[model samples]
Target: MKAHPFLLHKWQHWLALGFGSGLAPKAPGTFGTLAALPLVWLLALISPLWAGVAIVAAALLGVYLCEVVSRDIGAEDHGAIVFDEIVGFAITLWAVPFNLQNVLLAFVLFRLLDILKPWPIRWFDRNLHGGLGVMMDDIVAGVLACLLLHSVWLPLQL
Candidate 1:
């Protein structure tokens, strides 16, 4: 496909930017997440309970948005569409005790699970299609990461 007239044509720019992250060639997903970090920080500052609600809302909304944008791009699950990651990461951090240790651990764990796509994530990636397919794996990853983070956090709380 030709480079979009506006930011390389199509919604590629929007998608890459996490709808925009697609604009970046190098580590667009990472850049997208970085862009999302400020939002994360703002949400984190809220009571953790509220943060959890927001994460759920964001993830559900992301599914629809990611699907629409992914369809427009004619690519199933483009890497530039990192809304899944954004929502996933937010969910991973939600309600978890924040400290350098937990933050680092959650980041590593979320990335690992997201990249690995274990269990149902693998299933969703392979079996599902469209935007839901693109988003389901990340949701799975977020759940796994959240579980792991909670497991770690519970011990620390004692």
Candidate 2:
């Protein structure tokens, strides 16, 4: 695979690279998602609504950033472009309490659902193109991960 020529100075590229976490030579998506954990935890300190807003903003801005980066890189959803993963992780943790266990679970579940892309997630990933396509599949995965965490473990804790 040809390496993307990521200009370090550009803000959009910086975001597309997940603030440098997405620059990892391998598994950039995983690193991007991992980097989102702290921000999610910090946002968890605020209202969940605020976190939701932030995630929404990320998704919305990600469209332009992803599109620009993909075009620059000459590939669609290139591994180095990981803003979607970062935003997806944030969406996965929305409304969930700030706890180590929940964070870890969200990480695992989000990554799995994202990588596996079952059902609509898979459909969206395959059918969608450009920025919306890059972000939508991960959005679906994030929602499913959030739902799984809430449904499977909320009852256990209560």
Candidate 3:
């Protein structure tokens, strides 16, 4: 089915929009990240291993979600398709043990890497296409955040 903007009735469109969090007119990505928090917190509570699993699952699901939503909306990587952001933030917090301080720091770090799109992140965003393209840059940002988080924490542990 060749869907369009008028098809707001579809579940895929809503899912793509991060269930309307991404519909925010200003800083939609920030809202999308905020929408990811509860899920992140819940998964984090289940233990670090489960949180990692959930992130992986969400990312795999995100590939399909982006593909479907972008196709349905007649665009690729639409601003409103933020399941990638959700998954990315989840990745940022993986294995961190999820205290409020850690999660907030991850949020800030992920947003910075994501918005700045440094290095390979920018390359992936500019060069890739389709659903995987939509997800790859954010995944890189999450990885960057993870590394930064660990670097800081490890020094403190030393």
Instruction: Report lDDT (Cα) of residue 125, candidate 3.
Output: 98
Write model 1 residue lDDT over 1-158, tens digit each, in one string: 44642344544345434656645777665666556665677787899888878887877777777677766667777777788778777777778755678777877898888777788789988998876787778788878898888987888778
Give the residue spans of candidate 3 off by over 4 A: 1-6
Residue 116's lDDT within candidate 2 is: 87
Winning model by TM-score: 2
Q: Model 3: per-residue lDDT, tens digit, 52-122?
A: 88788888888888888888767899787888898888888777767878888999999999999999899
* Model 3: pairs clashing at backbone N, Cα or C within 3 Å: none
Candidate 1 — what's its lDDT? 0.72
Which order, best to worst by lDDT? 2, 3, 1
- Residue 117 local lDDT, model 1: 75
Candidate 2 lDDT by residue in tens digits, 1-158: 76458877788889898999988888889999998987888888888878788789889999989888888767898877888998888888888887888989999999999888899899999999998899899999999998998997779878
For all candidates in order, the CA lDDT equals 0.72, 0.88, 0.84
Q: Would you estimate the TM-scores of all the predictions?
A: 0.83, 0.93, 0.91
Residue-level lDDT for 140 in candidate 1: 81
Decide which is better by TM-score, 1 or 2.
2
How do the candidates rank by TM-score, highest first?
Answer: 2, 3, 1
List where candidate 1 sits over 4 angstroms from the true fold. Answer: 1-16
